[model samples]
Target: MTHILMIPGSLRAASSSRATARALAARLPQGTTCTTADPGVLPHYNADVTDDAEVAAFIEEVRKAHGVIFVTPEYNYSVPGVLKNAIDWASRPAYESVFKGKPCLVVTTSGGALGGVRAQAHLKYILNGMLAVIYPCKEIIVTMANTKVEDGILKDDTVLDFAEEALAGFVATCG
Candidate 1:
């Protein structure tokens, strides 16, 4: 079975990013399992406490997954602090980090028209620095998140189609 780890950037109740990640997971081929990693449960970045329960669980999730999907909300034109902290935790031991050679995709959502594009770029850079093999498919940015998602579901077919197309490429790439 192909296991995919989805990490949502926002922890708000009924979050659009979380909904989008779930919808994306639904589009994957049969037999592909998608699990979400909640950043809210994680502690702030601290190299000295890598073995903490939360960090340990997060690391295990990353190490076991076949690929990772990062669903993030933009904060000041960058990745949210919570999500970045998860990245920092997974990306340890330099070249030997679990992020090394791991397949990851960044999907950003925002209330604005840009759809957190800047944040996506920033995350890609950080992932690259960690030697993560980011998927080269078209970026999926769900803009106007407030309208696109309702009741914890992505309502726009266009945006979901974009996610579908992107995931197809991701699936192929991983397989």
Candidate 2:
């Protein structure tokens, strides 16, 4: 079974990005278990506390993950600070980090016309520095995401189809 770790770029209770992440998680292939990262409990990246139990546990989860999916939102044409900080925390220990060689999938949602293209670009570059293998397929950009989901479920078939296809391809490559 493929173990996928999903990270959403927002901390809001009604975050559209989180909703989209949950939607994608529901569509992952059978035998795949998708879990979202708990960045709320994570303190900002601090090398001094690198050995903290929470940090260690989170690192362990990333080390065991077969793939990672980032469901992010655009914040001033870049990724939110918290998500970037989380990535930095996970990419420590230089070339021996858990993110090394892990397959990464990036998707973005926003209320803007360009979705989150700029943030996606920044995230791709960061993953490159981490030596992660990122999927080179159609980027998933869900614009005006507030309207795409309702009652905690994706209400758009087109969006769901795209997510399913991307997830299927991701699983095939990583599995």
Candidate 3:
């Protein structure tokens, strides 16, 4: 079974990004499990605090996962500050961190027309710097996300199909 760690870029209680993440989690292949990374426990990134228990545990989770999936929303044409902070924590030791060599997939959601394309590009670059092998194909970008998710579920058949196809592609590529 593939164990995927999902990280949402937004922390809002009703975040469209989180809804999309939940939707993807539900549509993953049988025997694959998805778990969200808890960002609340993560403090601001500081090299001196690398050994913090919460950070250590988060790193361990990333190391144990077979792959990672990021559900991101654009914030001022860039990835959210919290999400970036978490990544910064995991990108330590200069290429020897938990993200190194890990397979990753990025999914962006937005209420705007572009569907967080800028944030996705920024995330791809950041993952590159961390030596993470991001999947090239099977990219998911949910535009007008507000219309796709309802009450924490993705209700649109079109969006669901796209997510399912992208996830299947990721699984096939990794396994």
Candidate 4:
């Protein structure tokens, strides 16, 4: 079975990013398994500390997954602090972390028109620095995301279909 780990960049239970991730997870093909990681459960990043069980588990999730999907929302023109904290935790050993060569697909959502494009760019750059193999595909930006998601799931068919298609292509590369 192909396992895909999804990380949402918001801690709010009703955030559009989490809703989008949930929707994507539910729509994956029969053979693919989707697991969502909660970055909120992790503590702030600190280089001085080591041997954090939560951090270790988070890294292991990335190491074991066939690919990763980041669903994030823009906060003040950048990725949220909570998400960055999780990334920092898993980004140990510099260029040789679990993210090294790990396939990643990015999807961004926003309440505004830009759809978290800036945050997406920032995230891709960070992932590139970690040597993660970013999936080559059109950017998936869900604008007016606040209206597109409901009840903890993405409700926009157009956005969801496009994302699902992108995911299919991404999964093909995972093997």
Candidate 5:
């Protein structure tokens, strides 16, 4: 069974990005499993503090996963600090990190018209820096995202279909 590590970019209560992430996980194939990681719990990145238990655990999760999906909401046209910090921590040992050779997909959601595409691009660049095998599909952006999620459920079939298609590509990439 394929194991996917999902990392949502926001710490906001009832965040639409988180909801979209949950929906994507549910849309995966039956044999696959999705585990959400809490980037918010990671401390600020520093070379001197890279060996903590939490950091070790995060690295292990990524190492064990078959693929990773970063569900992000744009913050000032780029990734949120929490997500960036986590990436910084994981991107150590210079091309020898767990992210190396792992497939990664970036999905962005936002209330704005751009649907966090800028952030998605930024994340893709970051993933490239780690030598992660980036999924070849185009960016998946959930725009006007507030309308797509309600009560923690992704209610729009159109958006869900789009997400499912994106997941299919990601799954193929993972294989």
Candidate 6:
């Protein structure tokens, strides 16, 4: 069975990013299980700290997953600091980390028309720098995402359909 680890960039419970992740997880095909990681529980990244249980567990989650899905909202045209901190913690030993060669799919959401496109680009670049194999597909950007969610779940059929297709393709490439 293919197992995917979803990382939502926002810390808010009602955030579009989390809603997107929740929506996508519910649509994953049979035989494919998913788990969402909460980056908020992690501490600030410190190069000297090696005994952080949260950090270690987070890294292990990345290491064990067949692939990773990043659901994020644009923050000043870039990924949020919390998401970046989680990445920094998992990225260890320089070029050889748990993220190295891991399959990754990025989905960006926004309240604006641009749909967090800039943040998507930034995240792809960051993942590339870690030697992660980014899924090669048309970008998944959900515009006006704030209104698409209701009761903590994304309810847009149009966006959900397209995202489900992209996610299926992403799953096909997972190792």
Best by TM-score: 6
Cα lDDT computed for each candidate against the true fold: 0.88, 0.87, 0.87, 0.90, 0.88, 0.92
Task: Give lDDT tens digits, candidate 6, residues 25-91.
Answer: 9988778999999999999988888899999899999999999999999999999999999999998
lDDT of 4: 0.90
Model 6 stretches with alpha carbons more than 4 Å out: none
lDDT of 6 at 173: 90
> What TM-score would each prediction reach against the true structure?
0.96, 0.95, 0.95, 0.97, 0.96, 0.98
Candidate 5 lDDT, tens digit per residue, 1-175? 8899999999988899998888888898777888999998888898988468998899889989999999989999999999999998889888998889999998999988889999998999989999999986766888999887878866778877877887877877775
Q: Which model, 1 or 6, shows the larger TM-score?
A: 6
lDDT of 4 at 101: 90
lDDT by residue for model 3 over 1-175, one digit each (tens)?
Answer: 8899998898988889899888889899988977999876799988776469999888888988999999989999999999999898888888888888898999998999999999999999999999998988667888999877788876777877877987887866554
Which candidate has the highest lDDT of all?
6
Q: Which stretches of candidate 1 lie over 4 Å from their true place?
A: none
Q: Residue 172 error for model 2, in Å?
A: 0.9
RMSD of 4: 0.9
What are the runs in model 3 whose C-alpha is more than 4 Å off?
none
What lDDT does candidate 6 reach at residue 110? 96
**Model 2, C-alpha of 22: deviation from truth (Å):** 1.0
